[model samples]
Target: MASVKSKAGANNESSPYRESARAGAGSPSLVAGAASLSLNSSRAYALEDFDTIATVGTGTFGRVFLVRDKKSRGFFALKAMKIPDVIRLKQEQHVHNEKEVLTEVNHPFLIKLFWTHHDERFLYMLMDYVPGGELFSYLRSRGRFSNGTGLFYTSEIVCAIEYLHARNIVYRDLKPENILLDHDGHIRLTDFGFAKKLSDRTWTLCGTPEYLAPEVIQSKGHGRAVDWWALGVLIFEMLAGYPPFFDDNPFGIYQKILAGKLEFPRHLDFYVKDLIKKFLVIDRARRLGNMKNGADDVKRHRWFKTVDWDAVPMRRLKPPIVPKVSHEGDTSNFDVYPEDEWKKEPPVPPKDLEIFKNF
Candidate 1:
């Protein structure tokens, strides 16, 4: 969103649903090496090559569809970005950034962008179809998660952030909606729209309000540390049933984040409390991952003492909940979507196709 660099305003309203921070249990998975190569498909897929099964999600820029490959009959999620819509939205650079980041980085915990193709009307992205749906839906259903479940998911997320930071990429957005569950229950962090590769800092005040870091709300230069802050919020919400700081308005939420006030549940463990305190530090320099030791310091914390780091990337840990998808074509996990086409565009000029030629 263009407001990434703008001040917090009424436009940044929180989703009434987003504030529903209760969560459920999940297990961890191992990570893979750096994504240094692009994907090579058997053959390039097209919009007409697949049958649209259903619309899985709608975002500011485009719509995500559950599609079946007619030739192989394999199910995949196709994220479609209409050219004229993106240009009108003024998110050209963000779209390009997402495509570039997806191509360069491949990890077990991160979503795989198989390949991209653009027609005159839209830019098409074929990605792995995560059948378990959003962690948000599961969280809302369970209200809260067990400590083991919370830690399991957090461990994988920690690995994801570690990988991104090592590559100098700051994932500005961290929320349950962006966290998809594989059929086996591992996290597949999706949507790289707000992701930016930065060695120093960028003053973009973008991110879900409840997850936004203090420095971001203050318009001070922020970096990978913002992601750590969001992680703290995520872990807390998973265990406590809600974020540590929340208010009806975005400005109010920002104010609470700046104040750094935290009211933990009395039943919470001291070690978990200590970890949250470490990451929620108002000063980005003092934040756990931002310190000299970086992510290791956070990983080595007492709360994660039982985690087997080596087994993490290998998908060895048994997840508590395996989604009940009987087949690859199951749409039972996703919310029923509206059937609006939003006015499709006819064939465009070559110049229009040039804009997304490399997508």
Candidate 2:
């Protein structure tokens, strides 16, 4: 396997996915030194036109940079992945799966994939930049959210998962990191790397251990219902600031998760508690948001009575907390890391690898 390096410098290659931009025609040219950036034929503008002001976060696959569009003067999170490294790690199939799922999904609650393109070495994904950062970090900073705040966030996530399930796609990964905040502070589900289209059922041991459902850990023929189970865990974390089934040892947590045991805080609201119980049910057939109840059961929960279903996406409701960054290009408060440290040539994969073919 080849080691991966950050693609944080300019490169020459025409993007295979370039197309006209949906935002409009006459988008500005991408800026120089914008790090492996390229224009997709399907997109009206090149990704490099935007100035990358700061690094929001990083993961094993790639680093997400906070960039501003020179044309729209808008903010966006650019997720850059090394194609050669992905194929070398044998994750090309996973990448393909994510792209397929992303292409088919279009919903308010889900993270928007504006466009995707690839060059000789890297894959670039231009995505909706949610400024508020990870929902997990927000929760950690605040310790725990109020009942109202928790319900509001939970409701949005439930809708996103419901929509994916309806499309026959199962979001195997559901954690705070995967959940991002839109400009209005609403939850947008991101990172479809672990997602899979379930024609019937699948048994893959994937996803974070804490958020994994019992059926997933058991490697049973799990379906879309696993998302519902994770929703329960998500709600628990939101309300109590931690998952109901957690331990220092992952094995212990898995055992508790399999047992379907839960310990709610005394201060949790009755409705919230009840909803968690229904979602965390051991029997997938009996879980909430199943074919019977669908997403309406979650929307109709007593805790969500004040929620305006139509207005949630519009962000008409007051956000629990607004982020410090007020504008798209505002990086005044953030101390951006030096680009040189992250700029290095990625390793090339062997010719035998099929994953590097399309990328």
Candidate 3:
């Protein structure tokens, strides 16, 4: 999850999932705002409260650990980010946005942040431990999903996306890597580095190249419309086994996206194609979710006609891929990494202390 900062059109390989092309110059008000947000639960936590179990995920600024709470013996995903790396990478605002948004929203399909704590060297976010690993791993294992399976998963994501938009938050990062399967196999959206609340539009160049919208690539001020565009890319990847636009590099991928050429596999039906097309439209205003009806327009599309809206959020719908977890701390669903890297603490500079004062 290391962030790669490069000029536009450069090939960024740091993340096989989402990559941050440009980092914000840091936001003081935003950081202060995030610091003031109250914890979701009454229980306050710190690094010593949990015993580290395994390394479930890693990124540019930090790594996610599967940790067990000492008091309750409960399992949780602990996201530990190095404060110096956060400042050096210019991801302070994003780190704050993630905390603020997670602190504010509660959705069945979205990952939950229990509490946040910061010591001199690192920022820690305690969240629910999703035993099921990234949806990307499963998709690769299966090659691709059947129409029924794809529809079921996409429907759940639709519910999650709708929930965020209703609260005026745009989930700018939407990809298979960010989607995690719960023990029951339902989707739990993760990673809020690119998510932000928008009254109008934001002109930050972020997100994965394959899923980036044309508006985002052009640096046009974008709002929630970008989420719909990524949804289209997500649907395409789910159904076709790959994104519609592809190239060896990010620039080429952007070209294909701007060209707006979509070639579906012979297996995709007309209804599914129509749904993706509407979501992938180059014009933001004419896009399905950006239309007058908003997310209802997406929910009402013909491709999702079979979905039970009420059941989707209630988690009544069975997930297609139930991860084989042995116990509460079972991490068989996630990939293993060298544990030593997490032990080597990075040096923290004193100059950056005020930036994370609230943390």
Candidate 4:
């Protein structure tokens, strides 16, 4: 890794990406540095500008569509969240938070939100069309990653988590499914529904059961430290092809996490073995990032010795596995979905949409 600097001079590539004038104005302190910051214009986009092709992915409150921008002939992933479902599921706050965070952040490793819109019944978020599919999918196909592959992706994730933490945001969800690979095979951390800008602490019983940190399971307030813990779990899963802690039930998973019982398989590299041990520490204060030097402590470790932090921000390092994307509008990398599940409705504003004015 490049020798750490305190951002005392020009924009540090090792730090967060530089923010544009618009982003800097909104969150001055969080705008550390970036080579090029594509701030969200928040311009109005008509439905006609985009041709929604197919459903690429879905969740409890929304579906992601492969959309082609008619004007630029570019492709994008449009996330459509039904307001009624959000309200019924009591995920309105999460929806708002996701939209707000996505708009503010612009990093190579973080998913960028192009613009957001609403048509009464649904809220729409148009973002980068990452067609390489989920990291989870890649891991599943390969079973596990080589040590070098794990180090490469893990280094990028470290930069991402550090950037979010510097911005006073805590990404509660960090797992393979939420981590998408771009066309170049670099990691793009997505799904900000569980993310929040909490500089201090927050008590939210959220995130995947297997990935939840011990502090979160305890209902004890947690902040950015939880993210580091999740990073540990993610690194372990990527190399081992499974999470360190698991059970048939959520309760059992929580118990394993609280117990902090980690059994390493044989033939693991020394750097990974030591780093995971430090990161999985149950004591939040003693955790990797929570310790004195913070994220730098983790970055400076021997495991990441080969990581070129500056190159990561500029995407100078070529990824190990670039997706075979044939064209700009390629959907071959994504899974196919049934057509019956998609719905088409008018853009008329519902009478009950007053709560979304702020968004």
lDDT of each: 0.72, 0.64, 0.75, 0.69
Instruction: State the lDDT of candidate 2 residue by residue for 1-359, as single tens digits.
Output: 00012111111111111110111111122322223222332554465567866655444445556677778777776666655456445556666676678777888777666666554445666777666556766788789999988877876777678778879999877777667665567667777766889899986666777887788777787888889888888889988988898877778888998888778899999988998998898888888877577888778878788888887656567778666767765543222434444444443444533443443
TM-scores across all candidates? Answer: 0.87, 0.81, 0.90, 0.86
- Which segments of candidate 1 are over 4 A away from where they belong? 1-42, 346-354
Tens digit per residue, CA lDDT, model 4, 1-359: 00111111111111111110101011011111111123375455655577767666654445667778878888877666666555655666766677678877888899888766655446666677777777777788899998998988888898898899889899877777777777788888877777898857988677777788898889888899999898889889989888899988888888999999899878678889899988999998899887888889998999988888788878887787788888766767666655454354333344547666655
Which of candidates 2 and 4 reaches a greater TM-score? 4
RMSD of 1: 7.4
The TM-score between candidate 3 and the true structure equals 0.90
Task: Name the regions of candidate 4 deviating beyond 4 angstroms.
Answer: 1-39, 341-351
Q: Which candidate comes out best when scored by lDDT? A: 3
By TM-score, the best candidate is: 3
What is the RMSD, in Å, between candidate 4 and the native fold over all Cα? 10.3
RMSD of each: 7.4, 7.9, 5.0, 10.3
Q: Please say which candidate is ahead in lDDT: 1 or 4.
A: 1
- TM-score ranking, high to low: 3, 1, 4, 2
Residue 310, model 3, lDDT: 85
True-vs-predicted CA distance for residue 177, candidate 4, Å:
0.9
